[model samples]
Target: MVVWNNSDTMEPTFILRAFPGLEYVHSWLFIPFCLAYLLALSGNVTILSVIGTESSLHQPMYYFLSMLALTDLGMSLSTLPTMLAVLCLDAREIRASACYVQLFFIHTFTFLESSVLLAMAFDRFVAICHPLHYTTILTNSVTGKIGLACLLRSLGVVLPTPLLLRHYRYCHVNVLSHAFCLHQDVLKLSCSDARINSVYGLCIIIATVGMDSAFILLSYVLILKAVLGIASREERLKALNTCVSHICVVLIFFVPVIGVSMVHRFGKHLSPVVHILMADIYLLLPPVLNPIVYSVRTKQIRLGIVHKFGLRRRL
Candidate 1:
């Protein structure tokens, strides 16, 4: 039997486990995690700098790319400190208020990434299907508004999560499943009825991830329809080629998300290591891969990077 504590009298700190059952190798695990963080940071920052400095990349697609880069940076920064502490130093205790704050940023940025990906999909749709009106449709003013809307929507939906969790009393087990705090992970530790939290969480996931993914797919369908209508096969391939990077990014973001959700819902009987590995992959893979995908696939970005490093002359 488990005992519940009163919210008013409960301790303020919660322990975070890097891997609850597999703690012996946590120090060893820090090497790859640290390398991933460094790569993600350097890759995203390079993309941002390249995009910002290159006047040619001032178009709508690159604007959305910059937004993606920013979200990746935020996602990486949000979890970096907690991850380092838990993996390297074994410092796992975090205050309730701090945990809530971290949870807010993590979820916000995650949703923000979804929103940005949807925006990028729209940008691709406009570029491929209606090339002439792309500028008019996604003007600087309009792009700014869309970016603001994404940020605002993410914040509005995630803002209530921490507040709701703060009211729930946690029982004996306050150890989180991962190095960082996630809304779902934190909610599970609460002893009180968390139907509200769970319901809200499901609703937000459906509203943002579900809705954005559906629309992104719709956009791609329209893009495919447009591409197929082209008279030349070469032109059709060329048109589809532009979307390969975005498609890879969408898969990188959503596949892990779906896997994590599935694991949470149905993998309870599985090892704790499976859950931890899935969660870490969901959080870490996008930031690390998004810039790499874009840098390799987009010519302008590649040239910009080359020019930035004075490698153009060498090549």
Candidate 2:
């Protein structure tokens, strides 16, 4: 969600330099970000720990389930430091190479998270949509393979970005305008033409996040058709209920990400600060909100947490 400031193109500085000074964010921003960063980490960790500590959760479903939680934790943690710095200090400053590196890993994790979610959606589709073959189809071997594939898919596609960026020699206007180094922002800083980076970046998006999202949507579409055909009213209600939480999660991920990207790309001149704020909000929203949505809507998860934590059942 970082904005690329091309206004400094005329400046006699290194073309590919990072922000020299930190733009200290206001206290208000810091307070929320501090809480959000902590919550995102804590919530995801709690889920991962729950799955790890409880023997009952050692099944294939929970393995992928825990993986998703772990991916979320990593994704959020990757972005939080810079975001928090943006919130806490008036000036946001990071080294050029470090900024780009941070950005690369951030995108890498983001891609991994999307892929994991797609796998989880497939798990749900198998369990609910094809109950008979669920165990056979989603065995330990299969889950492991899928997990490895997700990792490789993300790394394979996104690895080229940093490599490409490194090749481009940054020559004036070294300082980045945004708080974090984004590919687009970094590309914008390049004095040289960046057609290759742009093409690769787009391809990476299509391969990683875009492909994962398409599969997730397809899984749901099949899920919807399958659930709607159930004869019993109670059964239909139950099926719908099962998907409600995930639907919310998908919305949370799809809406803000696409929205912020749209705004950042087209709405650049409208309000750069708003652009920055939207990017921050979009990036953090899913991590902060996913646990809340799931807990509130999914009784099993909520009760599992309580049971695992030794809490009394509540009405």
Candidate 3:
């Protein structure tokens, strides 16, 4: 029942809600949100700097880590402007074109992160399971190709979403669920028939996130099998330890994603706060926690950090 007045000159502007039902508390939430942005920015930048400057750490693992840091940085930056505008300036208005641009980058970086994580999992599998052939398998050229492939795949898939949205004339209130533009959130506001959008969205999720998660799980299963074959308990522990940081990050990324997906599909009658919180967690937590997890769990990264900050002992 969409009232389609398709005029090219009449572009709709969207109102971004900081937190739909919790507008009164947005001021209080701003402090933590700002702090999280700062921490995520500083932490991921630090990881990149440490990896970039340290020659000893220029391996396939650190290369993938750098890619993860880049994605985290992109993800944080994609939402920072609108988030601040909504919370601080109360500037909730965003034009359709700008909104689509933001949506493209946010979704692009999101899928890119998943792709990088899958690449890292494969890196780990090779490092642990095929130690003798690790270098031959993940050479710098191959690694670059992998990174480029991830970027190209993400861009190609996400680019169509905004184009598809552009054709639809929106006649609803245009109130966004969170501080930023999301595909599903915006689609719901369209008065036009959205079956194609919905189906394409689901297809992207299944093709990208779903496939990546399944492959990551498969890589770990194979990794575990290889680890068990090691005769020495100490060797087995060392082998499994390498995957701990990646596992932590995977959980941080996927758990919130699952929560957001579930809420989107099943929790329509639920409070807006639940939906907002899940989106925030999915968008914010990985950037904030990924560096911390890597620094704490990866000894080389920890040492690189200490040395970078001149905190390493002279002894």
Over 31-117, each residue of candidate 3 has an lDDT whose tens digit, in order, gives 999999999999999999999999999998999999999999999999999998888778888988999999999999999999999
Write out the backbone clash pairs for model 3.
none
TM-score between model 3 and native? 0.96
Worst 10 residues of 2 by lDDT: 11-20
Each model's lDDT comes to 0.91, 0.74, 0.92
Q: Residue 211 deviation, candidate 2, in Å?
A: 2.5
Output the worst ten-in-a-row residue range by lDDT, candidate 3.
Answer: 1-10
Best by lDDT: 3
- Candidate 1, which segments miss by more than 4 Å at Cα? 1-11, 312-315
lDDT of 2 by residue, 1-315 (tens): 233334433322222211222233355656777888899888888777777777777777678867777777877877766666655654455655676677788787778878878888988899889989998999989999999998898888777787777656566445554556677777766777889999888887887778878989899889889988999989988877877777787788778879887996799677566776677676788888877776678565676788788988683
Candidate 1 lDDT by residue in tens digits, 132-204: 9888999999999999999999999999999998888886567777889999888888878999899999999
Off by over 4 Å in 3: 1-8, 312-315
**TM accuracy, model 1:** 0.96
Give candidate 2's TM-score: 0.87
Spell out the clash pairs found in candidate 1. Answer: none
Provide the RMSD of all predictions against the true structure, rounded to 1 decimal. Answer: 2.1, 4.5, 2.4
